[model samples]
Target: MSIQVAVNGYGTIGKRVADAVALQPDMELIGVGKTRPNHEAELAIENGYPLYAAIEDRIDLFDEAGLELAGTVEEMVEAADIVVDACPSGIGADNKSLYEAHDTPALYQGGEDADLVDVSFNARGNFDEATGADHVRVVSCNTTGLSRLLAPLQEEYGVEKARVTLVRRGGDPAQTGRGPINDILPNPVSLPSHHGPDVNTIFPDLAIDTLGLKVPATLMHTHSVNVTLESTPDADAVRELLDEQTRTFLIPEGAGIDGAGALKEFAMDRGRPRADIWENCIWSESVSVEGSDLYLFQAIHQESDVVPENVDAIRAVLGTADAAESIERTNGTMEIGF
Candidate 1:
């Protein structure tokens, strides 16, 4: 039997998650919940997804826009086996009771507080953490990327500490209201960014610090990472280890994929949906080690990397498959690798 999945929030992540869920043979995307009757709502309807009003009071707004509604979000949650809440930050917390009342499990995005869910999930780092849990939070894209790299290094080389500098895009392409459009701003303007603490939600004991800056570009977010390990491995050995990860895409220097623009172009040329690079794109030449420290530069497609993780989280919470099996099924079905 296919697991029935409903996505709440029809923004960037929610829309992508709905599409990814539809691709999974073991799951069915039953419906999507949207708070507004915007273009995304029209796209969902056009895609043949049943559209439910996330805010009951806003139903008339959708009607006013000439979009048909499936029902209220409560009705959708009642029918779904699981709900993926891609609502913006702070909103998911408000909708928790609706899912709880229906006894429907839910997976929330990283924007919500980690304490809002039972487990902070990263498919590779802690898939089992979400198994059978009623609620799970898929860590943010930045945290997801960091976890993907950290997990392997911690296992094979044993990390002593990690420091990361995140160069974040001001906003998603659709988010026109966001800024630093002309200038680079020190986001949070604080010592260590919240990202390091957010990572701790997945790896409680891991020592990591993060700094964040918002750049003018909306293309992609780039990360500069340095990890001090218990054992030093040469650059080639480090590359070999990261290359083994199914979700990590190593960008070879010889390929001339110099930056995010080329990487996005490469994804588009490969016919990737929305030019989405679901895998973490690490510069092959960036992998380096000195003594027991490892350093690398990687680009994260913030809008899309979490899409597959949400799919895997559904399977995890449902107990339908183990981590390896679920990840393999998701990767194969979604064509995740480069």
Candidate 2:
């Protein structure tokens, strides 16, 4: 049976999810829900996806904008086999009762309170934890990057403890309300950033600490990470281990691979609009290991890295694909090497 999926809050994440589901043969995009009747609504309708209003009272927004409403959001929830809520952070949680009321499963994004869901997911790590779970929240972008990198290292080298300093963008590029606009916003400076605990949700047993500093850049988030391993492995061996992830790339020494900008250009030159999601560019030049400590600098395409993870979460929910299957399929379509 083809899985009927509906995307609620069809903005950045929702739009990507809708497109990804439409591409999967095992899934059918039955409908898409948007807060207002905007260009996304027209695009959804043009693509033949039935459009549902996000808010019941805002049904008039669609009508006023001349978009034909498919039905109420409640109706879409009842109709969908799975729902992806891409609404803002708090909204997804607030809407959870509706999904449960309809006996439908939902996949949530990073922003929601992680404890609200039965599982927190990053297809590579904690994927099995997501299986058979009713509600799953994808970890934050920085957390996703950290988990993906750490899991492999721990499996192969045994991690003792790890610390990460995150240089996060002030806001996503599409976002207007965010910025220090040419200023460096000191991290919580006093309190611990949420990432360390956020990672604990995925690895309940691992000892990890994270600090964050916000920057005015909207391109991507960069991390300076240090890991103390139980046993030390040479730099080359560590690089090889990380590359096994398929989504991770070790930028060559001579390549002018600077920051997120070059990484994006690399993906575009190869014809990928949202390449950063899958191609986590961990600088080969930045990789170094001494004694029992390992260090590296990596850049994550914040807006896009989670896109593929979202796709993977849908597959996990429907039991259509597993980690191995998804990794193989995505590797075939994406050029993840540097």
Candidate 3:
């Protein structure tokens, strides 16, 4: 039998997750919960997903917008084997009790506090940790990118410490109201940004420091990463290792894929859904090592990179598949990597 899944908060991540879940052979997307009857709500309906009202009082709002509601969010939770909380930051914490009342296993997005989940998950890094857990959090897109790179290095050469500079997009393309439209702002204005701490939630003992800046771009978030490893490996060897990872797409030179714009175009050319690139785009030429230091540049599709991880998390939490099995199934079904 397929695991019944409900997605709450059908906005950015929620919508993508719902679609991904529907593609999984072992999962059934029961419905999607939304608080408003926006374009996304309409899209969900168009996509044939049953739409449930997240706010009971807002039920009439969706009805008035010419959309039908399946039921209330609570009812959706009750019917599902698991609920993926794609609600905005802090909202998942509020929904925790509702899921608990129904004894439904819930998976949360990275936006939620790590404490809200029994396990902070990255399928490639810690899939086994989430097995049979009541709640699991798929870490943020940035953390997912970092974890993908760090996991392989840590296992092969042992990471002593990592430093990353994150160039974050001010907002998703649809988020027109968000700013830094013409300026670069030192986000958080704090030393060692929260991202490092967020990564630590998944790998508690790993040492990482991240600095963040919000740029005007809305397309993708690029990362400049440096890791001090316990053992020095040749740059070519490092590239070979990263290439072997299923979710890492090493961008070779002469491919003419220079930036996020080109990468998006490439995805579009490949007929990807919403031109989504589910893998980490690492610059092959940028892979460098000096003594014990390893450095590289990678771009993360903030909206889509986490999509596959969410799929894998479902399998992990359900104990339906091991990490490799889940990742293979997800990547193959979704056409994740190039």
TM-score against native, each model: 0.98, 0.94, 0.98
Per-residue lDDT over 28-139 for candidate 3, one digit per residue giving the tens place of the 0 to 100 score: 9999999999999999999999999988888889989999889999999999999999999999999999999999999998988888889999988999999989989999
* True-vs-predicted CA distance for residue 338, candidate 2, Å: 6.2
The full ranking of all candidates by TM-score, starting with the best, is 3, 1, 2
Query: Which ranking of candidates, highest lDDT first?
Result: 1, 3, 2
Model 2: colliding residue pairs: 277-305
**lDDT-best of 2 and 3:** 3
**Whole-model lDDT for model 2 versus the true structure?**
0.83
Could you tell which candidate, 2 or 3, scores higher by TM-score?
A: 3
Model 3 scores worst on lDDT over the 10 consecutive residues at 108-117
lDDT of candidate 1 over 95-212, digit per residue (tens): 9998999999999999999889899999999999899899899999999999999999999999999999999999887789888878988887997898999999999999999999
Off by over 4 Å in 1: none
TM-score of 3: 0.98
lDDT of 3: 0.94
- Backbone clash pairs for candidate 3 read none
Candidate 1 residue pairs that clash = none
